[model samples]
Target: MRDGLSQEPSIEPQIELTRENLIREQDGDSKSIIVETNNSKTTKNSNLHNVIIHPRLKPAPFKIRDAYPTDLPKPTEICTVNDLKFYQNEELPVNRRGFKYKLCKPNPIFTSNYYSTTDIEPYEVSLSWFDRSTGSYLSQDCKALTSNQGWRSVRSNVGIREGIYYFEFKILKSDDYSHVRIGLGRREASIEAPVGFDGYGYGIRDVGGELVFISRRKNVLIEEGFKTGDVIGFEVHLPSLSQQKKEIEEFVNLKKSEIPDHHTTKKRKTNTKNKKFNNIEDNEKFNEFNNILRDQIPTKSKGVLYYDQFEYTKTKMMDHLLNPITVFGEKAIIEMDDKTKNIPIISNSKIVLYKNGVKQNETIENLYSFLPTNLEEIEEINLEPNLKQQSNPNYKNNDDNTLGYYPMLSTFQNGAVSLNAGPEFEYPPENTQIKPLSDRYNEHVIEEWYWDIIDEVEAQYLDSFD
Candidate 1:
């Protein structure tokens, strides 16, 4: 009785339990004892409002060519931070060592190479051609993979169609060939892509309007029939318009078939004896060795290499186009299909050095002065598209011919990604105009890596925190 009376409930600590009575309850029998002391310091109680930004997640602000170190991200505003400084001990948990950011540099880098990225590659090639036949889809034979064709490398690199590549193409031409168009193998154009991304990729067009050639640098030009032999190069753009339609029909107003790029060498009539000097070697090997030393004479002597003919058609264009050639350097000359004296543009499109921006009525040879002085600046230079403006002024779906631009569009609504259209490559000069991407229109919404090369000082600060 005395023990019960002496047990004062006020003095006897009545341990309280949380909602989880059993979980938080202290195991003590009316005895006060310490279990856990709040001695271990952690980030849980950190002053998030005043905490420094994490260096890992910090973003570097934008700047011009010459910027100061202090011009970097600085915590000026209460919310401003160079990086969101996350503590090592986080309750929710994140792998500290697993922290990663992507480092990518868009190809054909330009001044405004804007683009978006998916965790994975864009599955289907997507393109909305400027062609009039929108609803009706068509499939034509195309070799997007041949070396001479502009698309050879891109096809293999991008992983199109599973054997079939499950690719979609939109011809810029309104008409479909009675026969199938053949082969759009691989050709990639990551021209003027935004920094830190791969923006310039090729996608087939859907319209059959006259081809509009644009330099990688944004200079627009028109092409005519081959005068002198030139190396012509073009990109194969296989765009997946929509899975709903399988067949895409394209009719060529130009009446040229979509085939292989024609590579023909001029045939030279060999006098059994040189009409100029009759000691021409009888044996082929002797003539070959003689020709090797032909250049030994000051003026010049030449030889010929014979090859078969390959055909090509601009299904995407109302007129047939001679794609620009990849200048492997030096001179490249080819003859016409008929083996006539007509000069070919197929082999010599890239032959003349692109020295200057497109000039008014300037011959291709005169443009050689425009070669980039700085090789390092080559990556930033945009190549000129060897396409001429449509001959027909009343071209279909014609916009302002003087100020018109066609940017890459998406396939599905809120799905397809836009091509890189940025200004990282060349700085647009005054009086020049910029064609907005929105003018062309995009059906899908856009969503958006690169590594930070922290300086030694920055590295030390980051390591010190670690």
Candidate 2:
């Protein structure tokens, strides 16, 4: 009586549940189920089943695979290539850091001063002059050097870490406004600045014959300043290699500990968002990632793979002045042994100047104090210790082998000077202890022979790796 025609008795709908039905339901391909009642027909979708919730797991942390092989025992004998390979490997017990060690080939013909010698030529020592490739403001023959603008300096082709040697400089041309500074500088000394402008050099200025070191004038060496056509001689004395062997060994050990193995590759996740980097930390991270990528990429020049060569005797300018000379002096004195003291009491090195053939009264003593004894001391002056350790990877400090002096000459404002690295000098000093610089040839020959052996050994060792 309430509705039109549904007054008849209503019955409950019957429903069937099956395993295949549940499987079809989960697959989202189940057909709709129809339930027919006495009063009305009803349709229900199979997807409306009880929902089950499950916990999600975070992705495994990003991992980096180890690039090197298993550790190898330190080689006791380096006679074969395999033994040399083991000796150079980072996994060995003895510490070593470098991409690869290769021997530099020796030149067949070597020329110095006005003399030339070949591998077949008899062994005869000679003096060294200004290296033509090392100076752009020098004469075509490299005998005379002139500078018309700012201060420009050039060093001789050869240098010595030990022994007493003498060289002469003649002021060929100089005006009232022209100036010159003659001295000794290490390889890191800047060629664009005065010789004594930095700690790596010690010079005597022509202005007042003033002794200059670390950019400061210490004292007057000559009462009468040198003029045009004046001859100045320099005498250098350094401790023997045996005397510094202990210190050099300690330095090498320390450097081996500090240097990291550069053979491994580093991976980093880079940001993909296109936004400006306002945070310094983010910028630094980004730069570090880029540098790692750059190092991994191979660089080819003239069809040759350009691996960074080991810089044994050269370093960056900023690295040359890291610590003060006083630090090195303290270490040198404290590390001296009885054997080192048994020799002559000339433990302290010096640089003595001579006007014409006459020796000057003032002497620059404690030359070893100025030389960098360790890699830590090869940083810029006034630079914090932490900052020195953070120097650019490509600008590392030179090895202790490079801790020596080369004949240095500087000129300014059209000043011209000629080198007399001689077997015969216009005015040779009367000092019998000091030998002419030409005698460096004997040392050079011995050094070359030593390096030739090293090169052959390195070649054999590298071949084993391939």
Candidate 3:
């Protein structure tokens, strides 16, 4: 029935399916046999049998392209564990917690045998002058401070939590509208405001010699006012360690209870596609990789030759006024629990004022009651925690040091004052028990020695882990 085939075989008819024959067969012959081949020309004919080809059915060979930038600069070399030894031998700049660096200064007092080998001159622990970095409108030497427009306050470099210490201040100049307020303030006290504008500070104004706390003034403390030439003295006495242990424990417990449970907090929903990569194992691996990468990347700031990371001065919790006092009895007290019996009390701490070496009759007492009682109160007030405290969980627990009070000075328009943290005072306190502010140098040396030992131990512990 086919034209290509013959019944008789007198001579075998030879035929080849060439391009022309295939084309001719395809044009008219529906019953033509189709052949599939690897050849490029046959590919088109391979689908001639009403067959459909989808683009997604067969994937094409892929060639990956470079996605990263080629012209990126190489990263600077980072410090490693092995490189720490080299840094120890060299004098490095002191780096504070908030990425701040203190400018270089000579320390004559720090001539200890421990630091004799290195050129690293440690900073003096004693309060020599007002801190220039922390205070505005301060002189270059930090001894004199002035305010032009509004109230500007400055705290001493060092502060004390316990012991009876005395310091003197002399008003250099004060205009007709200008005034000065001298007091002690915690780190949380605002420099932009007067010393006693907030709860964290307790001050006395020169205008009326009135006692000030939480912006409220009480004229009963000092009857006579001081002038520009008068030398004002402050005597601070804090409770000893034995008296504060129980109270500190109770306060710590209250703070612990106030901290909300992390599990109870609402969590953000993760992407469905990325759920597989969000597991703990993956996170651990990522952290490990990140740490390695960080070690290879430099963290040094510009112009810094060499430096060491140090914890910045931590800020304490803000205090609240227990009860508004109009007048004082035999003793001014702030009770922790008014209803509870024998509850730990924050009393006996006193602040004595002196005008021109003459001791004032009135003494401000019971200071601890004004300090922060619990951590919840701190959060409710929206107080910001320090960098170290925010990052380290155990920081609060380990730092049991009581809220320290620093000599704070505030001035009004065109007001100026000079500090006298001295070995020699123009008007020294009559009390022999109360030490001069210069005696803090001994305490500083002792504290430094203790810290040095701790640092050595920490380094050894880290080396063991490595």
Candidate 4:
């Protein structure tokens, strides 16, 4: 009021109240208000949207500082740092306390794809019929009686329901029966009968090379049967088709009931002709010298189905295959069954047989009952329909719940034979041509042992510090 000539009318105090002013008035005069304005706007046109725009700024470049000792104080005799003093003793260098590092040689590796060390014991049993020696580490060899019709056999250490397996029988000696059969058989088969004598077992027989017999009742004259020092080879191939068929049918074709025994047929004939079978009625004992000649015919039918000669033309060629045995480790490769998870060939599982290095002309099929699944895995898979349907009484399925196959062999009395598995053999069979029984087809599927070994190694490593 003094500087102004009575300052014409203080216009600053005469301002009009706005909505913002009313809000501020209600909030109280203690709160502050800020006003911002773009004073440097450059626009030729009076359009608010035509203002120049600036791009968004990026984040500032960040850097970690280099931490280094610098400008340190000079060392002083009266330092604040507490010195760590270590006392020296007059002990010898050898006895001095230090890291006692000693490298140890690694232990030899023992691997088994099928049975572990403990589970493989059952395969080395000596049954009543077959007398296995003390050296029967893997049940690879056995001694048989020399009596005619006197038979002794044993189930193999490894049973294979599916795959191709080649086993050899070395003729250590021969008796009057002069019969030594080689091939695959079931545990339920009669131990007192040679292989192929019953339906449960299938094999080829060599009688002093005078005659060769295959199947149950088929006999063919040959130059000679296997003699001492002769290496007779038997091959087994479990095709995939057999397993697939088993999945569909409750019973596979091969497991069908065998033909009627001689006594049963003779009784039927007697009823028709008013005559009687006066001989000892033994259903297990079939007449080996029957008039009906056996052929190398593979049949998918299980029961006693009658087929006339006219049906031969319509028979599938694949069903009538007759696999031949070889000698002297000949090279004979024959394709077995269709490959599957357990079989070889990777794409389609089929077992092949080889003598020496040559492949054979024939192949064996229809052997799903002889193969085995992992015992540790059997309990978990017991409820599976496929395994339950394709079950065997000889092996555990329902009660025991174990399913596995071992190598099996049978010999008549007066016939002595030696089996060559991998462990006990003068000339071990080459594993090159065949997939190992201990080999798993798939690697991704881990087992309990895999985790067990891992946990064991970890524990051992941790214990090293103690």
Full-model lDDT for every candidate = 0.18, 0.46, 0.47, 0.31
For 37-101, candidate 1 gives per-residue lDDT tens digits of 22213233333334332213221211221011111111121111112120111111111121111
CA error at residue 281 for candidate 3, angstroms: 26
lDDT order, best first, reads 3, 2, 4, 1
Cα error, residue 158 of model 3, in Å, equals: 1.2
lDDT of 1 at 314: 17
Please rank every candidate by TM-score, starting with the best. 3, 2, 4, 1
Instruction: Show where candidate 1 strays beyond 4 Å.
Output: 1-49, 53-150, 153-220, 225-358, 361-456
- Deviation (Å) of 440 in candidate 2: 1.3
Candidate 2 vs. true structure, TM-score: 0.51
Residues 324-390, candidate 4: write the lDDT tens digits: 2223476766534431222111123333333333444444443434321211121111111122112
Decoy 1 TM-score against native: 0.17
Task: Report model 3's TM-score to 2 decimal places.
Answer: 0.54
| lDDT (10s digit) by residue, model 2, range 217-328 | 8899865869787999888888786665455445445543544554232222224243322232332344332221111111222222211222223233333332222335
lDDT of 3 by residue, 1-466 (tens): 3443222211112233133322211122221112211343333543554433211111111111111111212222222211111011112222223332222111112211111011112232222222322223544344556655678777775677668888888887654687888888765565667888766678888877898877888765556677677888888888765456456557556545655665232222344333322232332344332221100001222322111222223343322232423246676655343222211235678888888888889988776432222232233323222212323222221232224677888877757776777767888877778888767755644543454444334333322321
TM-scores for every candidate against the unseen true structure: 0.17, 0.51, 0.54, 0.35
